[model samples]
Target: MDKPTGSTVSPQEALIYAMVTLSAVDRQMTDRELRKIGDVVNTLPIFGGFDTDRLVAVAEACATITREEDGLHAVLATIATSLPKKLHETAYALAVEVAAADLHVEQEELRFLELLRDVLDVDSLTAAAIERGARARYRTL
Candidate 1:
């Protein structure tokens, strides 16, 4: 679905693609993960001016791409190209948050994070810090 991540893909759509890709990587979109996606859209400053009504449609578009051949790569490419350099870290953070939401980060999720880090050119230190923050935020009592 490279076409889905085409030139017209907005930054918001790119971000959603990142989160959806991670949440679907394990082939199980847990309630916590799904809720995290919704929360991120509703609360984050980055998502300011975004249309809540389009949330489901954007998410479905991304989810569809993830099931296609090299869909993950397609999504990542769209994200890297569409988002400004300032948002690379933000995109990674969003993905990490969703991965941690279920409090059981699967191996597939970890691999996707690693790949995303590289694709986004996120420094290892920054990536580790964001990941740690997500773990703290989602940790069980």
Candidate 2:
């Protein structure tokens, strides 16, 4: 939802939206993908202590974001630009986790993520670390 204030959405909310949108990209949402999203939610400190209701709200927000053609990058861009420099890695990590949720990093997803990483100004090393962690989590290790 775009508010008049134009204040950025919370990073956790943006991340949840990103994951849900990624899962819906193939026009299907599998249990595997849902579980992966849940795992990402649970593991990320930004989403710590999020309740079911909050998760659902975030999912709805994601649906709204997805409906927009700009997609996850727009949400990521908002958060990246609004938050402080110190939080960039946390945002980048969330982007990577969401991009990997479907167990297959589609080209569109990779492109969006790379755009976000660059916009967030995440360094190459941290982006690599995020990708490595995602690969490990998806059992591609």
**Model 2 CA deviation exceeding 4 Å by range:** 1-6, 25-28, 69-73
Indicate the worst ten consecutive residues by lDDT in candidate 2: 1-10
Give me the displacement of residue 110 in model 2, in angstroms.
1.0
* Position 117, candidate 1: lDDT: 88
Candidate 1 has its poorest 10 consecutive residues by lDDT at: 1-10
Q: CA RMSD for every model?
A: 3.1, 4.3
Cα deviation at 125, candidate 1, in Å, is 0.5
Taking the tens digit of each residue's C-alpha lDDT, what string does model 1 give over 68-92?
A: 8988787777778888889899999
Taking the tens digit of each residue's C-alpha lDDT, what string does model 2 give over 86-108?
Answer: 87777667657766665777776
Q: What lDDT is reached at residue 24 by model 2? A: 66
Q: Give the Å error, residue 8, model 2.
A: 1.1
| Model 1, runs deviating above 4 Å | 1-8
